[model samples]
Target: MDELFKGIADPLRREVLELLRKAPLNINQINDHFGHISRQAVSKHLQLLEDTGWIRIYQAGRERYGYLSKSAFYAFKDWVDAYLQWGAHSIDNDHGVFLDDTAYKKGMPLTQPVMLQALLSKDKTFDGVFYTAVKTTGIFCKPSCSANPRPDNVIFYDNKDDALKNGYRACKRCKP
Candidate 1:
């Protein structure tokens, strides 16, 4: 997903992820690792990581702790593995795979364009008809959720189980 790619694409955020991979760290502790960068900058990186599902932050009284999300890491790994497999087996100069309408439409209730439209409008009419998963947030919501996910970061599933199987969490707000 675009958000997963964007999350690890940043050098600084990657460094932070490397740190969290070793063990959970509190806010001040994570900040200490980057002495050259202001604490605010470090905090912003942590926020991005959390938003993109690379990390999860939880409050413990006064101390907030951060930890890597293994599901997120595994999702990224699976994506890379698929890409590597595709590249390795490709014929000379071969690239791209295009699916025709029948292949693309075989099992969907609503077309993608309509799904995007329904999602943007928060149309309750489509609730339970399909779910929209926001890649950046790693959460899926019903069409009625009060969310305006960017079209590029959205993935649609006829059922929530597919979204969960692909490593997305149900949105607490919508309980989808």
Candidate 2:
């Protein structure tokens, strides 16, 4: 877990993970996403991500492709789940502490309007940040998915499991 945290501490590494989340990319393709960073620097970050099991590298001929390893996040997810349950129970207790329930009731925060605009525009920049689930179709997709569902019928989830927990299936087209 320490290694995982160290590996993801760098903003560049996090960006790499976001890129990999969309699809596996060879080093060159990954480099294309960041013109400001050198190939060597990106390679170094990739090595760290791979060493920490956050990503997997596949070599086909001379090309090496980096793929996001979702299993690598299981430990962190478990930790977060434990705390989330604890927090929920604590919030439910009628004690001195008071909290806002509007965001929770909405399934997300007020910034959802911005997310919806990004979804409607098929913004690749927000690909890993959130997922849009269409109530009518009962399917969730990555922000960059080409399918444009009605914005009014959409709800956003921070991760695939959350969408799944809410009974939304993965989009066949985007495979969220």
Candidate 3:
């Protein structure tokens, strides 16, 4: 997790990931996108990405192409979801803690506690950021759902696809 976080810590690295999303590219093709940076610098970024398992580098004839690894991102998501789950369980969701828009949207939290708080308070700002999965009910809800769930029974997922894959149906109330 630390390696993955460190790998994506730089804006340029993140952009490389974004670029790779469109299509796989060799070092030269990737370096061409950033005119100001040296190819060596780009190589370093590619190396970092490769080292962190974010990308798979392979030789197609003489050219080496880098492709994004979906599993790496899934792992990252799982880690964040776990963090949110821990936060939701560790903190009191009713005190209005981490419920404020600034707290959840600042690119930091603000996930589990904020997610649970959003679920409890029906905060619309976090609707798509994460989904609330109720273990006992076997249903998932958008953060803005009108239904009130016990925080202890909730597991947070960053994507609705995950909730669906996990065999949890979307709630009738939220239609998430």
Candidate 4:
């Protein structure tokens, strides 16, 4: 709840999130929509939204387009639903507050390379979920490796550090 509230508390980010919720838009488009703020300012707000898991970005050719990310909202919804239901049987809630831990308990999210290696080693295939570092381009792919294969000239990263070391960026889709 703190995270969600803190994220939307910013006026610029709130506006950006509102715009992105409608449709994906390039940085220039977002900047144009709010004429008062410079493009870099808009990008900074978008970056904060992204860091807080409120929005996402996708690369189209050379431009990065932004969109709202609703996963955090979904997590908040789940937490509130469970809390209300459980409190119905527990102590009355007039002066009580509870910390929601379900989302954090889901365990460390596996990296793309680790998941990919596991799938390949087991001879299994999945279609979604992948990771990339800012270093690589034209190689945003899935953990299952079901996408069209890239040349061997493309180095494979076994973990986030390896990818980041080479400057590859994470894919906005699948929430990598």
TM-score of 4: 0.44
**Runs in model 3 with CA error above 4 Å?**
84-176
Ranking by TM-score: 2, 3, 1, 4
Index of the highest-lDDT prediction: 3
lDDT of 1 by residue, 28-142 (tens): 9999999999999999989989999999999999999999998898998998776566444222323233222232242566787767756765656568889999999999999
- Tens-place lDDT per residue, model 2, 28-132, is 999999899788888899999999989999999999899988887897798776656543533433332222323233345537655765676565556777899
Which 10-residue span in candidate 2 carries the lowest summed lDDT? Answer: 94-103
> After superposition, which runs of candidate 1 have C-alpha atoms over 4 Å from their true positions?
87-176
By lDDT rank, best first, the candidates go 3, 1, 2, 4
lDDT of 1: 0.81
What's model 1's lDDT at 69? Answer: 91
Q: Once model 1 is optimally superposed onto the true structure by TM-score, how far is the C-alpha of residue 78 displaced, in angstroms? A: 1.5
- Candidate with better lDDT, 1 vs 2: 1
- Over 1-176, each residue of candidate 3 has an lDDT whose tens digit, in order, gives 89999989999999999999999988888999999999899999999999998999999999999999999999999987765654463254443433443454446645566676677766666778788899999999998787877889999998999999999998998898
Model 1 — TM-score against the truth? 0.49
The per-candidate count of clashes, in order, stands at 0, 0, 1, 8
lDDT of each: 0.81, 0.79, 0.82, 0.58
Estimate candidate 3's alpha-carbon lDDT, on a 0 to 1 scale: 0.82
lDDT score of residue 77 within candidate 1: 90
